[model samples]
Target: MSVSEKATIICSKCSAETDFVAWKSITTDTDPIFKEKVRSGELYQCICPKCGNVTIIEYDTLYSEVDKDLTIYFVTNKDSYEKAMELLKSDEANSEEEQSGVFRVVTTRAEFREKLLIADAGYDDRAIEILKFITATHVKEVQKIKFDAALFDMQNGKYGFRFFETGKAGIFIPMVEDMYNQVVVDFSPKYPTEEKDNLEVNLNWVINIVKGNNNSFI
Candidate 1:
């Protein structure tokens, strides 16, 4: 189910207050247009009617794709993060049925977009994060180029990533299938044995796994 609240937002450029339908929760199955907007990073953009200036806004939203069994909490601050954690916990305790799916809490717009792309592409978020961590580590140690984020990208028939630095253009790195496959094979046994609800999988989870089984992938 999608939930939205109407609010009057003052445009930064013209100071014109525009009515905005802020989506608090989005269910992708019922709202394909919203899903596309969120995926393209344009969900929070508001165009000022008076000045035509585009303003990007950020807020906490719960995005869920029922078909994919994926739910993500896009949080912007510590308070929002805590609120999301509590909501997830409460849902787990009160729900009468269990739905095995991927649950994630992201603090950035880039991460929110990345998670959606990862889920849409049917990639394991864990393996993708592990791949990113490995690639980032390699670049830092060998190439000496520190990137802020490595976002998943698919072009033509290829699976690759676009690495972003603070002020530099994104550098594209083609996915190495062998490395990704090996990571899955190496870590599958240690991961969840049975499907569970709302499993938090991301960079931190991958880092912990790597630290414990450093030899497995390194």
Candidate 2:
């Protein structure tokens, strides 16, 4: 279920036009190796035959994990990104029949990677994002420091997170099970228990909570 298009791309280094297979959609169930290629960052890379230079293609692709019930559509082009947003907004009342699993709309390459990693690890990416938001709020309240980014990491059979501070590139603050469990416990009430068919609907709830609308979020 990996969809691709053949295109004649001009090599930036040698200016030689060569045919390349550009992947537009990838399904982990069918093309398993593609997931590894994504992790290695070689799937979107084209090696020029003439100059031997690597050219990175920035195009939109849908990354789907059927086993994990996740689908993330990534668009980098401005027009496509805006159109994707508009489509998602129009499908606000997205029917259960129209969905197979967690259908998330993403606009960046980093987000696409993060969501794919989380789904491959058998965890819910939306829930993890909510947990990160709560933990970031606590970090700011307690340590008086800004938490910029975080990614789920497993170390020594334990589920943890690696955090980055504002303006820091490689700064990581590792968290243990106790901290993660605390966030889960705190955010439990905000979870949408009724939407068992679509658990990610609660992501909007978490976003509203982040926007300072505690009572009206739900």
Candidate 3:
């Protein structure tokens, strides 16, 4: 079920307060429009009626696709993450069925969107994250700059990643399927099943995994 409420938002440009629908939790099965908005990168936007100015608002929300067993918590900071965990625990307590599958926490909106795309494309997110880490590391070494990579799309057996905050922004690098396939074969067996909700599986997670396992996906 999708949970939402009417909230007043003060426009950044106009300083005008307006009523907006704020979503606390979104279920893709029941809220396709909201899901689409999130995909189109318009979910956190507020338009001022007086000045017609658009403001981007970022908040914590739970994104779920129940049938697919994918739940993601989009949180900006530690306080939001704690609050989201409390809500998730309460919901789990109230529910009769046991929850399973990929439950994750993403800090940024871009990461949230990338996770959705990964899930929709039927790719294992763990594998994709490993691939992203490898690509980002190579790029950092070659370009002498740090970059955050996200899964853009896959075509002709090549996975494309868009690097954020690079020297030249919006750069796409094509990673062949062989890299992803090798990661899955090498690391998938060692990957533990997610028993805890909101497991954060980002680049940091991958780095830790690589550090712990001597021969794991270097």
Give the TM-score of each candidate. Answer: 0.86, 0.75, 0.82
List per-prediction Cα lDDT, in the order shown. 0.77, 0.66, 0.77
- From the highest lDDT down, the ranking of the candidates is 1, 3, 2
Of 1 and 3, the candidate ranking higher by TM-score: 1
TM-score winner between candidates 1 and 2: 1
* TM-score for candidate 3: 0.82
lDDT of 1 by residue, 66-100 (tens): 88888888898998787767766674643747656
Candidate 1: C-alpha lDDT: 0.77
Backbone collision count in every prediction? 0, 0, 0
Residue runs of model 2 more than 4 Å from their true location after superposition = 91-93, 96-98, 138-148, 153-168, 192-205, 212-218
Candidate 1 ranges with C-alpha deviation above 4 Å: 89-96, 155-157, 192-200, 214-216
In candidate 1, position 165 carries an lDDT of 84
* Model 3 error, position 68 (Å): 2.8
With candidate 3 superimposed using the best TM-score fit, by how many Å does residue 1's alpha carbon deviate from the native? Answer: 2.3
Better of 1 and 2 by lDDT: 1
**Residue 58 alpha-carbon offset, candidate 1, angstroms:** 1.1
Task: Kindly list the per-residue Cα lDDT of model 3 for residues 1-218, writing each as its tens digit.
Answer: 89987889988776899998878799988877777788876878888999999878787788888777898889988888887667665746437477667788888887898888888878888888888888877778886666654455655665678776643556678867888899899887666544442277777777767776867357
